[model samples]
Target chain A: MTPETVTLILDIAITISLVVGAVFTLVGSFGLLKLDDAMKRLHAPTKASTLGVGALLLASILGAFARDEPSLQEALIMAFLFVTAPISAQFICKVNLHRRSCMTPPEPSSDSTWATLDTADAGDAPAQHLTPEKG
Target chain B: MSFVDYAIYGAFGAVSLAQLLAMVRLILGPHTADRILALDTMTVNAIGLIVMLGISQGTQIYFEAALIVAMLGFVSTVAYCRFVLRGDIIE
Candidate 1:
């Protein structure tokens, strides 16, 4: 193909990627807002938003190549995001689980043991009104 | 305007609006975990916006910004989660 044709193809690819990435991010964020459960919210940002940003990063890489600069940094950024986004999501998920237990009615730890990590006193427990488990 | 130009602007607007929605969730979350989730989503959206901006500007610098944001956002999220999980950052 001619050089002009190649340029056109790259431009088109970049444009598509950009639009798709944006839509994915928006949908993911909307899920975060609308979803009622914490676990459910995890699905949106971890899967869709990550894919969205990944697409944009891919576009940036393509744009760089089209300009003859051919940057590898955007690729590195993509890799970093891929590695960290899940780990971050996992961490936040764990936090949510623990925080929920702390501030609400205690649940059995599956070992039949109630989770009483730091009962700092009556005042410390904000959700004391929540009935404690009777296991 | 060209198709590419339109895409750039549309991506910017969409991601920005998404970021706003995440902010609303952060403020209104009934549970601590919900707030944390909102914060994490915000960081992800911010990274997407930065990368989109980089593409639109045809620059390399914003790529660096996106990488930095990713690294720091992960660390902060992990640290905050750790605090909630263990009630302490160290030991």
Candidate 2:
């Protein structure tokens, strides 16, 4: 293939990736807006948005290669996002659980309560010292 | 403009629309968790926008901005969750 053909192919790939990324991002946000329940809404951003950004980053990487710069720093962003997306989702889930904002999760057969819901005895962990004293 | 140019423009419009939708959610969200989720989604969309900008301009400078936004967004989400869960971010 000629050099022009290769450049054309790369450009097509980058464009396709960009379009896909944008569509996913829009769908994710739309879900976030229209989902009936909070927990359901949580699924939209965490899953779809991550995939969207990942696609965009892939396009960025491809674009760099096409431009002859061949930089991989976009990979750093992708890796960070992939690692953190689920973690932040979990944290938000915990927040939802703590606030009782959504349907309560089913009880475990063995455990009396979920760890997040289980209140510790005062003796188990002292909390008195953490409170600020009023003058 | 070529097909690539049209695609780039379309992607920009779509991502910006996504950001606007997330913003509406942030304002109208019934629960704190919903708001937090909206903010998180918006952050992700912002990163998309930055990446798109970088792609269109063929520049590398936006990479750092995107990375920093990602880090800050994660940290802020965790902090918000902590505050909601225990009423304190540190403890």
- How closely does chain A match the true chain A in each prediction, as TM-score? 0.74, 0.88
- Regions of candidate 1 where Cα sits further than 4 Å from its true position: A101-135
What is the C-alpha lDDT profile of model 2 across B1-91, one tens digit per residue?
6677788899999999999999999998788888899999999999999998998898989999999999999999998887766667784
Query: Any runs in candidate 2 off by more than 4 Å, and if so which?
Result: A121-135
> Fraction of reference contacts reproduced per prediction?
0.82, 0.84
Best by lDDT: 2
Q: Which 10 consecutive residues of model 1 chain B have the lowest summed lDDT?
A: B82-91
- Candidate 1, residue B42: the lDDT equals 87
CA lDDT, candidate 1, residue A101? 29
TM-score of chain B of each: 0.95, 0.96
Q: List the residue pairs that clash in candidate 1.
A: none
| RMSD list, candidates in order | 4.9, 5.0
Error of 1 at A47 (Å): 1.2
